[model samples]
Target: MARIAVIGAGMGAMAGAARLAVAGHRVVVYERTQTYGGAVRGFERDGFRFDTGPGLLPLPAVWRDLFLKTGREPLESHVEAVQVDPSARHVFADGTEAALPNASRAGVVAALDTALGAGAGQRWGDFLVRARESWDRTRRPLLEEPLWPNWRVLAEREPYPAVPHKRLLRTRRAGTLAEIGAWELRDPRLAALLESHALAYGLDPRTTPASAAVLPYMEHAFGTWYVRGGMRELARAVYERCLARGVEFRFGTEVTAVVEKDGRAAGVELAGGEAAEADFVVAGVAPDVLDRVAGGLAERAAGEVPARRSAASRLTVLLALRGARPEGTAHRTVVHAPDRDAELASVFDGAPGPSARPTVTVLRPDDPALVPDAGHEAVVLSATVPAALGAAADPGSRSGDPAAGAEELITAATRAIPGLRDRLLWHEVRTPADIEAATGAAGGAVPAPALAAAGGRLLHPANGTRTPGLFTVGGWSHPGGGLPHAGMSGALVAGLIVEGPEFRGSQ
Candidate 1:
């Protein structure tokens, strides 16, 4: 049996470890932090619990596949996967609100028709139809399989069948997401609803490819899910699965370097000045720090997806409220920014600044375990912010309150949560600084899922590298970020290792 050493105990790394161990390999995971799950972390105070990372999970089939491949126990047995009905409530800039049902095209169309007047729902439903086409075209290449060697083919092609819109002189199909909104959706509120899907993943709708329609399609088609208790439970479940597979984890043991022998990844060097030899190595850390730890490993590969220097980060405010959550409240609510242009300008990924108002996502799970009692509630508010102006990189961001974005988030949240400030007992703000500390991501910038078009700028590096026996997984690599994509990254890495370079796709 080959000995495998994995760097980082994130979900992706652990997922790979579990599958490799089940393949009868000896795997040891070294994590710098005292916990697993990378950015999937939780915070608790006075009976109130908050998931500091992703509040809801989309495309849970990825995890289901992981569980099925690794063990007999279904994912449902470990954590209660509750399908959130009325998937989400969106409050448009025009004060119009729509509650979309989970995974029901007819229900969502009807709801949008009722809320946005005639023709709006039809437009959105049609858009989703086109988005589905994109999903069917790219799903295997982007999510299920290792990134193709000729990835530019995926990059240059736009699978989204955009409707022909005649703009005065020329008749052309919409190219970017913004064009999809303006040419097809027509209504500003519908545009806001469409763009919010991209925004939630830190992608700028203005420039994101039309192929990104797959983002919302994945949610609408699959449905959003919440783990019982908190999202941290999902991380705990995966960590446990790795342990069950005999994967060894050394927490708080940081990896300093990726040692090489015969020009192949030989093992890893630890911070304590000890070397652990292994036959193969897998890295799940962010792309920014990957070079530092692995000595420019990604750069050695030819024509791999360029490492994303920076992406949008999130500013989250965890609220401990005094009152019980009202029954019938939607599981998730998105309050769109009142001034779209202004908010978009300020929240640009590389340029951090305060927006007068920015789009905010408010999550209030119905789970009683999150609160001390029925008399209290746990609420999480998240807003996309620039990757920089972080205390770690910007002098200005450090000069003022690092959590200054909390006020902006709270202000935008007032639309979703009535009397929000009044209901609060206390609140804690977690900035990009916290993310950088937790995940070692520069400026805590979160990577978005890989998208076709935009000349392949959004695609991440390939799973295999120039250095043999070394593979990179997680958000920084192929298939890109988000829970499902990261999990798939692990699967791809295992496939490449177990089946060798000829590995095509999971059966």
Candidate 2:
């Protein structure tokens, strides 16, 4: 059995530690903060709680596989994952609404047809068929296996099969996601729906490859899920599972460096200069953090000096309300921006400032666990924003705080929540600064999940680094970010470590 040192107690690191321990290896995890879960965090006040990170989970099979591998207990037995039926309700700019069903393509089609009129549903349904092709073409190499040495092949090839469109007798296929929306979907509402998926992940639809269609396809196929209490409960279950498997954890202990010896990662150096020697070192941090901790060893292997990609952060406003959460309300609602083009330009290209009309996602779970009583409700409003590294937290600043972007979020969310301003008892803003302090990511940037194409810019570095025994896991590494991708990154890292360099992927 090998002695392994894992950095950070985030979901990805914990997943790896649990699996490694189950493989009979000794694993020790060092976390900078007194908590686990990384971005999957939650906040509680006076008996009310809100998930501060991702409010929902997609591709839960990732965690399910982890639990199955690490222990005999299934994930469902540890945490009650409730499928969010009518997965999400979308409120378009034109006062039109559609509630998409969870994991049912036909149902989604019917709902769209009913809400948006005839032909609209068929266009989206057809688009999904193409998206599925992208998923099938890329799933194995992108999510299941180790990133190939020549990752450029994946970057150069676009897996999404574009539909032929005849514009004035000339035939052309859609290249970017924006083209797919304009050429195929046609309707502005359908275009908005399609682009929203990419925007949520901090990708610019106009620039993102058509392969991104796989995103909506994945969600429609796998469905969205939520833990009974909050996403934090899932983290607690994973942490407990790690402990049950005999993996040791040290919270509030920051790892300063990856100790190297003879061109191999020997172990890690802690804040107080304490060294824990190991045969293998697993780092579950951002590329920037890895560059610092590993002394550029990781950056060299990644073929870049910094090894980090530009990331987008989130601006969230947690609302504590005095009214009961209405019964039969959809678990989540997306209020689309009034001006789609302007909104995209503001977020991706224009000066860092609040969008005059920003797209906002409103989350309000019906679980009583989130409210002080039957008379109260907890609502969370979130928007994608630029990550200004090392900046102070500005919650809806009056000084044109572009990074805050909270005011626009509030304005957009009003469409989703009735009498939102009236029921608001208190509100708290969670900014990028808070994320940086919590997760150690520069600028509190949240890395997007891996995509198939885009000249390799979207692909994460390989799990294995140049330095022998050194590996990168989590959102910043192979398979990229998001809860499911992070979990898969852990599995991939463990597979490489336990099965040797010849390891292809998880069995």
Off by over 4 Å in 1: 349-354, 391-400
Q: Pick the candidate with the highest TM-score.
A: 1
RMSD of 1: 1.7
| Tens-place lDDT digits, model 2, residues 1-507 | 899999998888898899999999999999999989998899999888999999999999999999989877799999999999989999999999999999998998899999999989999999999999999999988899999877888888999999899999999988899999999999999998999898888888999899899899989989999898999999999999999999999989999999989989999999998999999999999877887898766755434312556556777889899988888899999999898877776666655544547788999998988887999999898877666533554433222363346666777888988798899888878887777888888877888878877887788888888889999899888888889998999999999999999999965
Query: Can you write out model 1's per-residue Cα lDDT over 397-500, one digit (the tens) per residue?
Result: 22235445677778788899889889988998888888888999987788889888888998888899988988998888888889999999999999999999
lDDT values of the candidates?
Answer: 0.88, 0.86
User: In terms of TM-score, how similar is model 2 to the real structure?
Assistant: 0.96
lDDT of 2 at 442: 81
Candidate number achieving the greatest lDDT relative to the actual structure: 1
TM-score of 1: 0.97
